[model samples]
Target: MSSSVTSPERKKIHPHKFTLWVAMGSIVMMFAGLTSAYVVKKSQSNWLEFPLPKVFWYSTAAILVSSLTIHLALKAFKARQMGRYKNLLTVTVVLGLLFSVLQWMGFGHLQQSGVQLFGVGSNPAASFLGIITGLHVLHVLGGVIALLVIFFRAFSSSRKTYSPVSIEIVSTYWHFVDILWIYLFIFLSVV
Candidate 1:
């Protein structure tokens, strides 16, 4: 008697979602390298140690809140509650913008405190911190742009059907950047 072989089915991810995962992986590597360099540079003489700006705490709160709002937005989208989803998404976008503004303010505060971001006589620690945090802010801005795209598409009359894939992608990215910020904040604060 011949035995038949059975194979379990494999679930496929959306191409866009897969692409996003790949991009996020690259970002992780980049940040890891940057932080490693920071650690190595910290041990060298002439490194300046300063307290992180208070505004960073507020920015962290904004990002954390934005993550929750985006998560709820995704749930609402899946539940077909368009109104609630839109409202939540709007809040997430606002929070993202707020986070960016807070970061800028924090930089300003640092400058006021005599931490030169970049110049002929800038400390390596301040320069590294500025570079790392600036990169993170750019990623956050990218997420905000993605949110805006989804927000506009949802409001468009041409949108005839719900695309959970799009919402999922944006939500995942938003959560990623949020978590990334938290990690960086903790690293900077402790180290």
Candidate 2:
């Protein structure tokens, strides 16, 4: 043979999953930029540092438990345990909502403690905290919405679409948000 060429095969990821990963990467970049700015701003004047509210811990616990429930839900889906999966998914959705509510309460605590979130007398530090945590809560709400879709689908008597990939994707996104919150909590606590 005069010449021989060989190409290695590439593994493929599901388009939906690939899209989710890309979106997640973008989210990471956005948070990274925001947190970086936070650190830099901290060095400047008029940056008031306040204690993170105790409710944040409760929210963290809620999200962590939600992550567990989502993980279990995915497992149940894979095992064809529809009842368990549906129950676990319901718990995950409730926990997600609880996390969001706790986060709002945490902000209330901050406001009560004289940390103005925004407006004429707001401190930059408190403003940043509000922006970052609020964005995270929005992401959690998005996950909750996704879970609700799956939850409703699971219970639909008209059509039963038991797509494991869909469940897996939702589970992955839920875990991602959960971990992101943990990272943000630690970052806020330390720096």
Candidate 3:
């Protein structure tokens, strides 16, 4: 008698995952460079000083709450709770939009607070804050787009199997952005 062993098939790396990770890594490096510059510029002499906008604190809270909503949506998808998943995803999207709008308002508030991005024509500190937050806002917009894509995909026929994976990936990306914003906010506000 001859016995044969069968090996289980390995899952291939989805192209979307690779692309998403590459995008995320690029974003990480972008912020890394911005924050490093911020630190270095903050140490320079005669830096123009200005108070952080209070709206940023509100934006931070909104992002944090959105993270929780996305997390719960992922959990609901895993548990096959479609209604809960949809509700949570909707809430997450709303929160994300609110965060973006608040960030824009925060920028306006900074302007009102007399925070100039250049000091007497040449201040690195002012430029640092403006550039860093602007870049962060751009990335957050990208994240919002990714979340919208996932939300639409969730309504398809294969929703049960594929929706969870998409939601998980989008949630991961969203949470990363949220955490990045929190870090930048703290660094800018306190350091």
Q: How many backbone clashes does every candidate have? A: 0, 0, 0
**Candidate 2 lowest-lDDT run of ten:** 159-168
Quote model 2's TM-score: 0.94
- Ranked candidates, highest TM-score first: 1, 2, 3
Per-candidate TM-scores read: 0.96, 0.94, 0.85
Full-model lDDT for every candidate? 0.95, 0.93, 0.83
**Candidate 3 local lDDT, 2-41, one digit each (tens):** 9998899898877777778898899889888888877777
**Across residues 1-191, which tens digit of lDDT does each residue of candidate 2 receive?**
58877788888999999999999999999999999999999998888978999999999999999999999999998888999998999999999999999999999998898889999899989999999999999999999999999999999889676678889889999999998999999999999
The superposed Cα distance between candidate 1 and the true structure at residue 177, in angstroms, equals 0.5
Cα RMSD, each candidate: 1.4, 2.4, 2.9
- Candidate 3 local accuracy as lDDT? 0.83
TM-score top scorer: 1
- Residue 130 in model 3: shift from native, Å? 1.4
Q: Clashing residue pairs, candidate 3?
A: none
Estimate the TM-score for candidate 3: 0.85
